[model samples]
Target: MSATYGVPNLEHCIIIAVIHNDGTMHSIGVINLEEFDNAAAVEIFAGRSLDSEEFAIRVVAVADADHAAQGVFALDAITGAAERAGISLLNVIMTPKIAAGQHWTDLRTQEYGILPDPAMTAPAIAAIVDGFGPLPDAEEITRLFTEITPADTDHARTTQRDNPRFGRDTLHEVRKTIVEYLRTYDPDWADGGVIGADFAADERTRLLDNTAEGLAARIGVLVEVSGSARDALLGLAVIDIPTAARIYTHIANQLEGIHRAHMLAVAAVLYHVDGRPFHARDALYRCGLAVLGESGHLSETMPVIGRALLAAARANVETDTARRFLALGPIAARRFGIETPDYDLYPAE
Candidate 1:
């Protein structure tokens, strides 16, 4: 994926992606060089802060508008970014151009002009597959979390309105309900499917904030990492990860903006807390789509995907599956202050 680079204010595009040895690729996505510089650009090329140690990298800048000049690409900022980030800026490339071409030059091999089309490249394929292909479309993804065919979310909304949950007495009841439920909740949730309908609606009710204050009760119940949600999610993921993903996603769909974002984070916690990386990726990817499809709100989906990036990066056992989600990390951290950098997937931590 060639990105637009800025050499004295040229509006161009370029992309940086990594293809791991396992044939999976991740891209921080197309970056506008105009908006980046030596220091700020590190978040694009690497991460905001080192997680454990410096990450190794080999960046190949897709020369914007290849000139006949043998090797002239605007690479100073890129070179400087690598230095600042303490990474190996392995090579710079100046491809003759793409489409009906097959030769290119890199700093190492210095090969010239290669590839049929950007669409045929490894990163492009992975982007299509992982970002927007095969997975449920945005609308469907939203529905997965919000659908009331089996249970009614509007009823949940209605209950909160009619009950005046903000009352001192009712808030106490809400708090009591959550505390008691968490204390005794069967994490396995394998109660023969008979209780799922009634159980699901009750859970959805707590998550809806149709009124501004309604969201408080739900956040109160689940925001604490030490809350039983950690143990419950861990046990549920082991027993039926799909069901847990389904439940949390449904709970999130009724929310808007930051509210929806937090519930989506729960999916990351439940799956990755126990090393279910593939499940984590799928659930988060769909959750990302759900956020995008949301109406009437300018939502910040960065945290939703950021938590996914953290889960993938921290995965110890499912390296291959985790690689599928690596490219989304920087978008979460590097994007401007729409969401916080804070994320904790260990519900009990």
Candidate 2:
């Protein structure tokens, strides 16, 4: 293993690389303390000495003046370990963006800041290249993208419900109505069963398709890529029709405006109150808007459908709506889950 030096108080270090093997380069990112250990182990497993020409390593430190010395020492220790394992050290230094309690937000901002404006008519492909320039392989870029993407389904749902169109009181009434409707319409079906069948399959699909087209119109959006890239991502693989029907029925009961305006309004609300930083909020909102604007309907009602999900996140209030929300996102509703957004649709540039 090779060695480097940095301060001790640094909270986190990320390793970005493109490793070449069998004539192919794979881009990758490693985070957390275990990553360093794994890198060292890899060097040992390869049986190449750090002093030998066959091994190479790079280290980037991130810390402030308070822990600069310790950070340098830590880097040296990391390099020494690699050297002992027979890995050669490459470049190692502190990244400029390092700060206390700054890992999550800073990474998110750095990633989002490079996204191309969706409104741009020319290819936003440049943005993708710029954002991922540090990465050496496609796989690494994909991983980085996933890492930065918002996974807080709970927060997304809360913002949707808080919309004026579907405030807490409204959601309650909607839930009550759905329960009663299910009971009255399907004598043999319980609330869950009715949602799984009648509501999830038919109504939800119609809503999502309509919302997607509507959103596309509102925000002149286009995705650019080779035919192979386009083909790789295009499909209906993510949608669960039955789940969507059931979930939307629950949403209909919870909010008014079964129309495009209502959908966009709900998206805007979700964009604002989800406790995400401003840039993330903007990305999510843009995603929602693009969905509605492109499909001209709720082709993937996950954005709006996700609104009812909040009830499940709250510990004390597990209402029927909440149950339905949780059920919709989980694997059990495999047949009913709504379509997720395509990775390409994300603002990667």
Candidate 3:
């Protein structure tokens, strides 16, 4: 029988443990289910072969079955993967407090035993089984945490279905705000031609003409508007910024490449204003890459972009965000290139 560990939400990975009839258990693989669905599990399973072994499988969850619905892998997909992997899927079990030596029996008829001694508890157990190193020192561990943590504010709790004004509407409102701000404050930036109107109409038309490959262009137009508005919104403290951030995050999640980056930048700025520096840093890292892509300076291996990304990382006050962003520097360098010497003061380590 084989066993799998599934986290329903933002964890983004499933731990697959292969168990032999002889009772030997080994956590064989960690699967990253990007979209968090049953189909994703099936895809992961289809990629592997179990040598035609008769395998019964069980899935263990850290929370109850209800928690699984939030964003966890679908139960059907787990069973499907087991079948494809040449194993029988027995059941799915949940453990509310993974390390408490307890589990939710109601989730499945079959009960599975905990891992024997020397294995860490549930939350840490998976990582230990995956062969990770010892835990970091308290100081280092503390340093890894972000300074401005999520506070579960009213805006943070806003749901998509609740208000239903997240996507294009939010962007339109932000554009209007930007136009009013520019007209009232910075007339020079608008060139006196059109101040708050849809400046991206031409770009949008060009992009729509080639819909197959215009996602980045679509994102670029939004990004340009958002970028222009960012400086203006910096001093304004209002709920609109949070709303825009939420919308940008939603947009970024739907896109790739430059569009994703630009949307993330808009989100980052909003997050920064909302005092969520950690989220801002993540958005900025992607934004840096997207900015390069937008500038038409991306290359197969551009160290210049890497240096600029590194600079953004170094300038960030949040240490953990900086570390994470810097980690992507080599990756960006290898995929894109652009020289923005203005950021040179903050060299990436």
Candidate 4:
């Protein structure tokens, strides 16, 4: 019976039991079920069920009829032992069939509420993650600059050149001086150690990293100025020197704004990582003033100079030209072997 039931090496004391309809039970030496219902349960229990109701009733009747059978009492004891062992005969019979009828998604939902679709969530997560890095490319900067109307540029340039307090030559010289200075100091500027070539290269590789783009935008200002100057010199258009000055001033202001934004973005990243609000506002103000000073406009450039100085002062009180001189005191002393004045000496202000 054990061989037919696939219950190999059955323990002599591990009794099998069955319940019947006649309010009686029977102890069986082995299982001989007509059909298997639950594969998992069957695999767990091996084979152990009555073949049919008729067979169960006959077994119960036979046990009840024989006084010395001991099968009925043994059945009760065996059933009680199985219950105490946490084995469920009915569950073993039906679990596999029930599992086969369920869908994978249904089971997931039942186990864990609603599962999020990866397709819908991935792009949004990527976009949010990408925003923590630098800005877009130089092409975007150029595109935005090109959007400035030519008429507006002309008006600004005219205003700066014709101001009674400022002359065209002064503004022109400012442009020339800056260009020469950049050419002469290119190596020094490159060596300043603020930003390195390798850093720029790494930034360039990442589409969202825009340190190179910021540098490119600064360079683009020179390109625009040169192109405008060439057109003026060639008589391709009526060159309003004052209007040109205003345009140059506007470019300087725009560059300052870009520098400020870039600094703020960098500071934000640093703050996130280090939990320190490093005072970058002053650095930005100083850098912006330096860019404006290099714009090549004279002190008498009135409204334009006044406006730029005001902007600088608002960013940092110490960013005005006088304060700038003070900040450069060390360098001036090194170069001239004397203490430099806290302010510009030539202006006598």
Which regions of candidate 1 deviate over 4 angstroms? 1-59, 63-90, 95-103, 107-109, 112-234, 256-265, 274-349
Computed on alpha carbons, the lDDT of every model, listed in order, comes to 0.43, 0.34, 0.43, 0.30
**Is 1 or 3 the stronger prediction by TM-score?**
1
Candidates 2 and 4 compared: the better one by lDDT is: 2
* Per-residue accuracy of model 1 over 1-349 as CA lDDT, tens digit each: 2322111222233345444434344334444444444454555656544221334344444444543231233355565666676655445555544433646567555655555554555544664554322222446544555533222334444554565332333323333333334422455453555566567557645433222244333432332212233223323333344444554555555555444555565566555443444455555555555456654342444453345455555664333333233223223322211221222334456
State in Å the error of residue 207, model 1.
19
Off by over 4 Å in 4: 1-145, 148-170, 173-185, 190-349
**Whole-structure CA lDDT of model 1:** 0.43
**TM-score, candidate number 1:** 0.31
- Provide TM-scores for the models: 0.31, 0.28, 0.30, 0.16
The number of residue pairs in model 4 that clash at the backbone is 9
Tell me the deviation in Å of residue 83 in model 4.
Answer: 84
The C-alpha RMSD of each candidate to the native structure, in angstroms, is 15.5, 20.6, 18.1, 30.4
Tens-digit per-residue lDDT, 1-349, candidate 3: 1122222231334445565645555345445444457666777567665543534455544444445553244555676667666775555654443433443442446555643222344534665444332243335323322222212223412432354433244334444443343343333445664544465444333332332232223433433334323222222213244543543454455554554554565455455445555456556666566557656565532233233444555764443432343333233322222111121224555
Which runs in model 2 stand beyond 4 Å of their true positions? 1-55, 95-349
| Candidate 2, 206-225: lDDT as tens digits | 54344222222221111111
Q: Summing lDDT over every window of 10 consecutive residues in candidate 1, give the lowest-scoring window.
A: 1-10
Candidate 2 RMSD to the real structure: 20.6
